[model samples]
Target: MPHTKFPQIIVFDVNETLLDITTLEPLFDRVFSDRRILREWFAQLILYSQTMTLSGIYIPFGDLGVGTLRMVADIHQVTIEESDIAELKERMSTMPAHPDVIPALTRLRDAGLRLVTLTNSASGASPTPMDKAGLSHFFERTFSVETTSKFKPSPETYHLVARELSVETSDLCLVACHLWDTIGAQAAGCHGAFLTRYGNAMLPAPGVPVPDLVASELTVLADQIIGRQ
Candidate 1:
């Protein structure tokens, strides 16, 4: 919508972008006596996932999520039980798709744009988050960094999608709520659409391009894409 060429595939970032991670706040409220720790815990999970990737180390995202929860608990000097960790894992897998997800996805698919998801989490766990949230039907495929053995913001992850889809990187567009995720795809030579969800916004910087399109609502983003068609 910013006078840009339309991409052949729209690759979605699953967590937070498609699904609502904030639903896990009650778990944090129970574990740390403050629900806001949810944000810190997720931030640590992302930080360490990328850290491990940069160090040439590979750890499954689910495992990293568990360890991150423990690390954050330690940082806050809050004791977390195995039950809590189990509950956290359960909640993570069971998080709901954001209310706008289905309609936007439906519109995009109906408009004949290819749709898929790329997540840092495993591509196909037994009942992956997409499956659990009932959003899998909207996507032609779902992808994960597992195949590349590299977490995102590392170009290899986005490259994997292009390879698997047999398309040039330029034919793909990464639609995401996180600036880091969008920037990573842009660096990999793909278009980026930033969904400015709550708790997220653009941070302009030199030498790094801004997202090709920015919209707060997924529906609006969908409309923009459809308009381009």
Candidate 2:
């Protein structure tokens, strides 16, 4: 297990880390199959997020999901019914937690660590995919950049999470699978840990402490937290 001084509060990035959205890849291949189509959907998702951030528009991530799905359908020249949309949402609504997620969160909760989630997903809609994954019970709070009308990699987004948790940014640690996110947190004055899922190369962030500590799985991170104590 890696090591870090214990943190009073830990803020996690949702989506790719805790909840495995890759489950959709198979379903997507069956429907749209083409790699180009999948890339298009992902690209549009990021485009829409940037659009919302720049235009001061705030649409729930759920709505964005549905809309992006429809856009992909259009791109693939396929048609979807309201029922299809509903079914797609149902599929996403119950995202599966990664194998390492629950055990790690269980340990963190048992250790009395304050766990919270900070995501770029929209809020006040259906429960987050994480909540649906049964990990919501482990977190003390769930926050989204939608509340601040900004996406991450922006200091404002990190600051918003700290503000919502009522912790000084330095008092919190940001755990994420993406280097951009870890760098953003550090720039925003929070400590960071990068879950280097596959030894991905870090982007251009110097002085980032090479992630402070690295873990391939959340369970290892939990052990690190415990070891620190």
Candidate 3:
């Protein structure tokens, strides 16, 4: 990209960018039938993540999910057992990566790019999904900022990633599917790529580029990031 100094470390946002969460949707729907209810669950999850960060109240991301589910269950007047919660946690460890992802990551790793994963997912659920998808080998490290108690779109989360990777903010690249995430990374001084897997509309952001790279597939995005075809 523009022959600028490329980042020494490439950091990825896990949930939507690296690992596809679509498989977990069916399980969520089965547990909470209403689509609107599912939407609220996700909404509150982000809300609480920010709330925890802003208010200086940190909770383990897994515990936060359990609490969010309890809130949903209470509203629906249904009682959920602890075993059901454990099952949901188990599923997080099983969600697979996108079809194009492994080969793309392999290419980057083979090219000698240092890879790492940064996620807002809690410490209780650290790196299991990457391990399950066989992606753990591609990354030199995996970070769950349950330690920071913040989610993406927060400068703290982005900065935490760079700090943990022991790379300069300018020497770290952040690739993700969300616009807010790219903005946060850029704000935190990282080069950014928007992984638009579904061709979603780009939210307008002035001056600062929306994404240094944009691609519908991870393979193409990897090429651009590595200055390949």
Taking the tens digit of each residue's C-alpha lDDT, what string does model 3 give over 1-229? Answer: 2435878588998876877666656656666775356556656776887788778788777678779878878888877788768876777668789998999999898888989888888644445778888788898887777656676677877788777766678888888887767878888888888889753447875675677788888999998988932
Question: For each candidate, what is the lDDT?
Answer: 0.90, 0.75, 0.77
lDDT, residue 67, candidate 1: 93
Predicted structure 3, TM vs. truth: 0.84
- Using lDDT as the measure, the top candidate is 1
Ranking by lDDT: 1, 3, 2
1-229: candidate 2 lDDT, tens digit per residue = 2324556688899867787766666556666765345546655776787678678777777788789989889877988678767766677667798899889888988888899999877665557577678888888788888777777767898898778777778777888887777887888888787786642456655555556657888899778866765
Q: In model 3, how many backbone clashes occur?
A: 0
Stretches of candidate 2 above 4 Å error?
1-6, 34-40, 73-83, 124-128, 198-201, 204-209
Cα lDDT, model 3, residue 189: 84
Top candidate, metric TM-score: 1
Per residue, candidate 1 scores C-alpha lDDT tens digits across 1-229 of 2335689699999999999999999999988899999999888899999999999999999999999999999999989899998998889889999999999999999989999889998765568788889998888888889988999989999999999999988889999999999999998998899999988988867777798888999999999878866
Better of 1 and 3 by TM-score: 1
Quote each prediction's TM-score: 0.96, 0.80, 0.84
Q: Give the clashing pairs for model 3.
A: none
Going through the candidates in the order shown, the clash numbers are: 0, 0, 0
State residue 199's C-alpha deviation in candidate 2, in Å: 10
Runs in model 1 with CA error above 4 Å? Answer: 1-4
RMSD (CA, Å), each prediction: 1.8, 3.8, 3.1
